[model samples]
Target: MNSSFPRLVEAVTLCFMSLNESCPRTVYTLALRGPLYLLFAVIVILIVIGNLLVICIIIFSQHLHTSTNFLVLSLSVAGLLLGVVVMPFSMVRSLETCWYFGKVFCNFHSTVDIILCNTTVWHLTFISIDRYLAVCHPMEYQKQMTNRLCVAMIMSSWSLSSVFGFTITLLDPEIKRKETFHMNCFGGCFALHTKEIGVQYSIIFYFIPVSIIVTVYSRIFFVAVRQSKLIHSYNYNPKAPLKSKGFKATKTLAVVIGTFLVCWTPFFMCNIIDPIIDHSVPPLLYEVFMWLAYLNTMFNPIIYSFFYRWFRETSKNFWERLLNILI
Candidate 1:
């Protein structure tokens, strides 16, 4: 009994007490764990509520039913799914440093994570294109950006992301071997990518989309500047309205692109570098970068509230009506 007591005490710190190959848990002090749990829980709640509110606003507000707003709605859905279907599970795994849900679910979780994130990136890229057409080619904007085209863009983003995510996570035999090797312990779940895989993923999901966004936005800026100068030079400029719209586009570009870079660039940089460096990045630092990227979803609705007067007004009306109903 005395000899077995030592093993029992040691087992308390492992993910599975009965299994010799169980992963050890990162047991935090009570003081630290309390705050960490609270923080992640609050973030998950906010992400879900904010994305849902954005969807509601877009659905009920007639003025918000534009092609661009449809794309925004799709983006909100992706955020909502991430918050609902992904973040809670990740929160537990991240905090506990153990995977309770077994190997199959782990792959599913990882695949969904890749798909939703890529979906968000693709949506942002398409939105940038939409803005380019609206600001730089106002006369052709309505004619060129038809509802069919918008639907096509949305469909393509989702389908391509799904294919890529599934192929990498489930279908690739080499990646499967690497992932299994990484999850050597019974209670651990991790996906390990080779250096080549990491670089390919980063290029496809981050660099390509970001490059397109930057190039298109730069063109929009120059065109807007030219239009503003033309309007200022003429006393009676018919294109004054276009110049005003361009200013709005500039504001939108700054907030959207700036926030995206601040949130995601670190994570993607680490994603590529970690594999090249043989996963030298500390786990805590990697987790921090991952959560920071997740914050982009939470911030999307807040951005709308701040930058969109129409959204604010609609939100106000929504609250007032709900209060009246309750009263």
Candidate 2:
């Protein structure tokens, strides 16, 4: 009788365990899969389309071969690479909440990701400084800003980005390790006391670039206002309306600076906050901030199209051809 009673209890417990095991799978399929899968699809589509448009416009337009446009082209290429190569894989991991891509791919992804992101920031900084010089010292700018100098500047930006990014890669092996399940993960690199390295990276990657951007833009704004005043003072034939070229240029610069601030501020804030937060930030919030950072890539082309008449005309022509074909 005692043996029969023990067996009956064991059988009931086994059945309960089996039900519990299946319940989560059922719940996940019903509750989590639909929304997350749809969201991921939408994000991927937006990123691909937005970046593709930027690339196609740059490639097809000969007028876009200017120094500024060259920087923009580099930025678009990097963003496209990031969108296709890194973001999709990241979205996959976020969906699964696991780094399933092993250590090798993980390190490579981190390296490329850092390099591209830093390059974008530095390129913007360079643009800001270039515009400042052009506005504040127009004569010197015309004399000194040769095409060769522009190419050298672009090359220097990428080389510096590579150095900083590769430094992080060298440290990555020490910072992350494969879990027992073979998932690669962040192992508290930011949490521990690595104050000197953190400060150095912060200075190089964030502080200096941002400072240069702000300073240059400030000077550019002042110069623009002064130039506009001088233009207003000049006597013109009553028949000829005065052109507000300086004001218009300043307005465009403002848009560029504003977009840069809006798009990048969230990312820099996230970097600052990550180390301070004891618990992990909600994944959704992290993703929102990340996409906000990436928003710069999409916004840049729009800024160019809006501020530069040439880009607008080129983009319109490209779309018109496509529309005619589709029709």
Candidate 3:
């Protein structure tokens, strides 16, 4: 599956390259320039700032270092790597409209991309399961979500993501080979195959994770609503001790899940549609959607800040200290 997938990607890449060369002077190419540059800048800045804030919040605030927070921190780290290591390459690819970085860099770039992408989804999956346990079975959550287990889960997530990503690197030799600059170099056979692989990836990396998140969060919402109703019924008293906190936390989780869905849905939808639709999508359109998926990394920290007070406060403190040093 690993080797075959890259071959497929390569084939698809060649097809697209052919189409791109043939249509270089088309309306699509002319329309892409300004927006693509703007998108590149915006996405890079957002991802850098957002992921940095996440890391700062996690690092400086000792109280925020719970097992759940650790998972979030790991996610932030992956996001940071994606922003720094992956986004620049994507920008370069967009500007050049070809893989000028040769085969080795291409392989490494793709490897990093896959690893980070998989890590993001897997982290979300792990978090959803954790939240489910916490909300549905509080006693068991307290027991099972120990520091040791948290570490193990994190390690497992990284290891599993790495294994899948590395498999792709090992399977595709052409991924590491520099191709001659033929007109067909942009999107030929290899490119078409890549497109198919992208569609399949939407199923593997996106649809499955989304399904898991939706199912888990749906159950969580139902449970929380039921519990809230029960609490309200039992206590005619105006002040219910846990009501506010529980409600706030549930709302925060909902926002987190919602942000993930919003950021990723368009990209995945494009992947699914591009394969079915025979007409070539504008390169700029693909670039826009690609950055949209990349925006997921940037939004996580912002969502955390908005929804979680501790993260917001910690971020403020960290920035204040940095400014103090600068001053």
Candidate 4:
């Protein structure tokens, strides 16, 4: 009986052995655990390095300093901060099912996570608006999207995101009381939203932004297609320099929007539905959705590399200069 009691206690391990308030730990098999760690490590490394390259390229290459690229830079900066400030600890917490960083750091981490991710979404929405002007109203685009105006948009994006982040973190239910359930015990960290809050959050953060992006891009795509046909039919180059550039940029950013939708829609859908269904969704499923959303940042740089000649050329030149300095 004594030996069996020890085995039972070992089987039901708490994240903090000495603390009764600690959440129970989840134990995974070695095979599953090894690959999960390796995958997250690779994702974290890629997200950091990829966004860093984007930031350096945009900052150093002065010719790329247009309104469009400024917005792209803002997006990249948000992704970089997510990778550096929020992701590593999130990776640990997600995999281990425990928050070892304590309640204070956990709140800080959660707030930054919301801010960065929300900022990225806002950046995308603004970029879509910028592209709409360029492609749909080329004559007014240059006059409208001035450097000062673009900076203002960037600042507004960050400010709104900051407000939302802090407000949401302050409103987290876990901050006010301990959970009786195993999943949300003291060592476990996650926001607990009621059905009403979940619906409101999803509507505000996900649905509204996504709706704007899709509507604007739908207009941009059809307009581009019609313009292309008209240009080809004429067999003579019109004053298409602005239109051509805008179309290409639109195409690249359309891919970005599409990728963002794919990666995040599932998570947000679950976010809304889980609370409606009394939070019956498994914890592991939430972790998987969250990580999938995180992977979007890593993919953004890869998308740029594939689609943007400027990205490829600047990257090649930048690396060459570094190699020359080293040699």
User: What is the Å distance of residue 21 in model 1 from its true position?
Assistant: 1.6
Question: Which regions of candidate 3 deviate over 4 angstroms?
Answer: 1-35, 173-196, 237-243, 276-282, 325-327
Using all chains and alpha carbons, the TM-scores for the candidates as numbered come to 0.89, 0.76, 0.79, 0.91
RMSD of each: 5.8, 9.4, 8.3, 5.0
lDDT of each: 0.84, 0.65, 0.72, 0.84
Of 1 and 4, the candidate ranking higher by TM-score: 4
lDDT of 3 by residue, 200-221 (tens): 6677788888899899888888
**Local accuracy of candidate 2 as per-residue lDDT tens digits, 1-327:** 355432211111211233332111111232464677787667666656766787788787777777766777777777777778877776655444444465578777777777777788888888877787677877898677778878887888789989977887776533332232121223111111133444466678778888888888877777787776677678645565444665576678789778878877765666555445532455446556666776676677667767888777888898998899999
Cα lDDT, model 4, residue 101: 93
The best candidate by TM-score is: 4
lDDT, candidate 3, residue 101?
65
lDDT of 4 by residue, 22-51 (tens): 888886655666788899889999999999
Candidate 1, poorest ten consecutive residues by summed lDDT: 3-12
Clashing pairs in 1: none
- The per-residue C-alpha lDDT of model 4 at residue 234 equals 72
Compared with the true structure, model 4 gives a TM-score of 0.91
* Segments of candidate 1 deviating more than 4 angstroms: 1-13, 172-182, 235-243
